[model samples]
Target: MLNRKSFGFDWGQFITGILFLIAAFVVMRYPLATLKTVTFIFAVVAIIRGIAILAGYSTLRQLTGKLAWVSLLMGIFDLVIGV
Candidate 1:
């Protein structure tokens, strides 16, 4: 009696849960890699955020006055931090 729209099961969450469980097992099996693994994940996140900020520069171009300069500075800072 479960309708597709009302079924509270979110497929994406289910898949993510499974993946997280697998990751936990892997981390447990290789305790020494825990630090390196976490660092690499954070690095990737930072790099992606930096790229997003850089891309927003184009949108800021339409704005006037000091806003443009502020956007440019923020984008550059994000890129430097990521690198």
Candidate 2:
């Protein structure tokens, strides 16, 4: 039975998977490298994502919407964890 409803996948998952692979390889290969560099990148990413989520909240009217809420929560969580 084909319902009228539909679901979509996010491109972010693929990008994140690729990034994780790259990060793992880089970290493994350069274990002796400065930790500050990795921490800096993590911080930058978290900050940027947090800002993006905050901006999106204005356009996201429905708190029940999964994408809106998930994005906002993930952004805040990432920022906290990153810091």
| Highest lDDT scorer | 2
What Cα-based lDDT does every candidate model obtain? 0.62, 0.64
| Pairs with backbone N, CA or C atoms under 3 Å apart (clashes), candidate 1 | none
Which window of 10 residues has the lowest lDDT sum in candidate 2?
Answer: 7-16
Q: Residues 6-76, candidate 1: write the lDDT tens digits.
A: 74565434554555566577689989997776555445545555566567667656645557777777667
- Candidate 2 residue lDDT tens string, 1-83: 33737645544444555555666777888887637556765665666666656676756746446567777787788778667
Q: Candidate 2, 62: how far from true, in Å?
A: 4.7
Question: What local lDDT does model 1 show for residue 38?
Answer: 54
Regions more than 4 Å wrong, model 1: 1-30
